[model samples]
Target chain A: MEKCKKNRKLIWLTIYNELSSEQKSQLEIHLQACSDCQSDYEEALRLRRALDEKIQVAPTAAQLEASRAELHQRLLLLSQPRLQKSWFDKVWQIVSLDFAPSWRFATAVALLTFGVLIGNFYSRKAATEYNFYQQQISELLESNISNIESVTYDPVTRQVAIELNTLNDFTIQGNIEKPEIQQLLAHSIVVRYQNLSIRKKIPESD
Target chain B: MGNEEELLIRRAQRGNLKAFEDLVKRYDEKIMRLIFNMVSDAEDTRDIYQEVFLKAYQSITNFRFASEFYTWLYRIAVNTCINFRKRKTIVQHDSLDSYLDGNNDNWQILNTSEIRNPEEQLINKELSEQIQKSIDRLPARQKSVFVLKHYHGYKLSEIAVIMNCSEGTVKNYMFRAVQKLKISLQGYQQL
Candidate 1:
């Protein structure tokens, strides 16, 4: 009849080692009337006492010392390898373990690399542009020298007299219209001097 | 309680190996017994015993005086047993029937009033071994609590500190363990 109860397992554990004095008296009174629960109580007590009396056997001293030595050796091995490593090596290992470069750190580094590349690209582009301008200035200076050396010019005022004093022939000429040539030569000198002044200013920008 | 042991512990925490070995010598027996009562294998007991002291040796520098040294050692023993239980796939082996020196050589008189005969004496020995098997069969936490409470005679509060649990939890584990042990050993009565 007691076996059909749902909480019988829990009840068995409850009465395994514990019962109040009143509960014990009550159980005793009930056991006197019932043979089944009496057998249950006796069996339970027997099991409990057997477990209580179970003794703990001690370890042999030899075995104890041997095991201790073996364990110490194992720990010593684990602690040994790192001792030979330099401080930098240890720091690197620790940093690698603890603060690995996550996606965020990688992204930051990648962005930094990208920025440096862009800056270098712009700097190289500016250097090439400056060089190109310098080459243009040198070509302009060479053109100015060819024009000045091919024409007869006054060395003091640095004027090009145009065809009026051509360096091709030095003989005196007759029947040449001198006044018209002088007007034309005067205008060519003014234009050539102005162009030379403008060409000279271009070198200052270099 | 010895001044020399106290001095050794202090020196061990300062990274002295000789002092650590001295501390190991002092508590090795007690720690071995504490582990033996759990696994009950001489070989495994020796293994766990070594691990406990080795752990103490390795971490001694970090040992603060937060608790008694013995308590700290006991905690290490319990933890090693628990970890051993986890790493081990299965702990059940054949019985110690062949191994026990059963020549009736060292049978001390156990409670002369209760013991009856050689047959009863044999039954007692078998019963003790059966109880040990039943204890090994317990869940790891329950077995640890029961061993600490029953064999080592630790207070529930003391066990709580070592186990890093509440006293109520320790007592509850002990209760459940005892109940389970009772049921498991009941099968032996038929033998």
Candidate 2:
């Protein structure tokens, strides 16, 4: 067979009646010229005949009727509302990916839910950070002097001495709601800004 | 398909049970036979028959007028047959002499009832069984190609369309199947 390898396909195609008349003629000429191809062609014919001689069977009329009847019953059942569920159907419904579209929809829903959750977390964090900055800004706008290091209240004198955290150590002693106490705080803020401006000016001078 | 059959399919797609049943009646026998030929078991064939049509029903709405309706249906039927199991029986080894070697082997004897001569009857009956086994032993592609060609009388080109392969591939499958059958049947009866 390997001796006439090209004709192997041609032999089968001819046996199967798939070749055109021109192709059949071409194969015939090759077969006539090549003894190996001739033998192959003859062998292929014998095999085709052997198969043709075999008996063939199909479903019986009775079997067909039973199948059709069964199908009809199933179709009728499909039409009617089902009162009960089989355990397998219930299980399959739960477990089945329910095909591609539903699985994709579930994934989309999950990703959206996840996105909402992440958004919620970051927004809450942003709100907390905003509140923290608001407190700092309010403190700055109101009294300006911050980072009160320590306080000592002298009960007999009715005086509060607050030590301020600044570039230089400083203390203010006054009644809590007194105008003098407010003046000290304002003065401290002015000195702090003055120092900040001087620091910026130094950088430019350098 | 005729106009009426086409119309019936359209109605079936729209969920008309009567139209569907009418359509089923037209092709059910042939479909069942094709399934039976592939599986070679009545019981398995029936189960496949129901599954094929049920699948067709479930997916019919998606069936646009793509090819011939039977081609579409055969695609479903053949795919079900292929997926159902490649070869139901363990492929028999090269040839046993005794015709009734295994009665349990579900090889159907066809057209043997009409044989009057006892000796010829035996050969014919046994030869059919042997041939069927020879066919079953082929690889799935080769088996399907031979079955669709030999049993169903499908042109190789048509089979390519049905099997979703090129005609050249179908012919190659046919050649390989014949070669396998030739080797398998050689040990037993000539046919």
If you assessed candidate 2 against the hidden native complex, which CAPRI class would it receive?
acceptable
lDDT by residue for model 2 (B73-147), tens: 888898998888854445223222232333423333455455567687678667777788777667777888888
Please give, for residues A85-106, the per-residue lDDT of candidate 2 as tens digits: 7898766764554547757678
Please report the candidate that would top TM-score against the real structure. 2
Best by lDDT: 2
- Worst 10-residue lDDT window for candidate 1 chain A reads A197-206
Candidate 1 chain B: 10-residue stretch with minimal lDDT:
B102-111
DockQ of each: 0.23, 0.34
Q: What is the lDDT of residue B14 in candidate 1?
A: 71
lDDT of 1 by residue, B1-191 (tens): 46776789899887777677777877787787787777766667766776777778778877777777888888889989989989987785435443344332212122344646768757876887778878888988889888877677676777888888996787678767866876777678641
Give the per-residue lDDT digits (tens) of candidate 1, residues A1-206: 65323223333434543445776565567666767666656666666567655544554545555666776677567556454768998667654544455754765676689899999999999788656645543444334332322234344444333422233322121112344334433444465543542221111121
Query: Once superposed on the true structure, which residue ranges of model 1 sit more than 4 Å away at CA?
Result: A1-45, A52-55, A68-206, B1-4, B102-118
Q: Which stretches of candidate 2 lie over 4 Å from their true place?
A: A1-3, A81-206, B86-116, B189-191
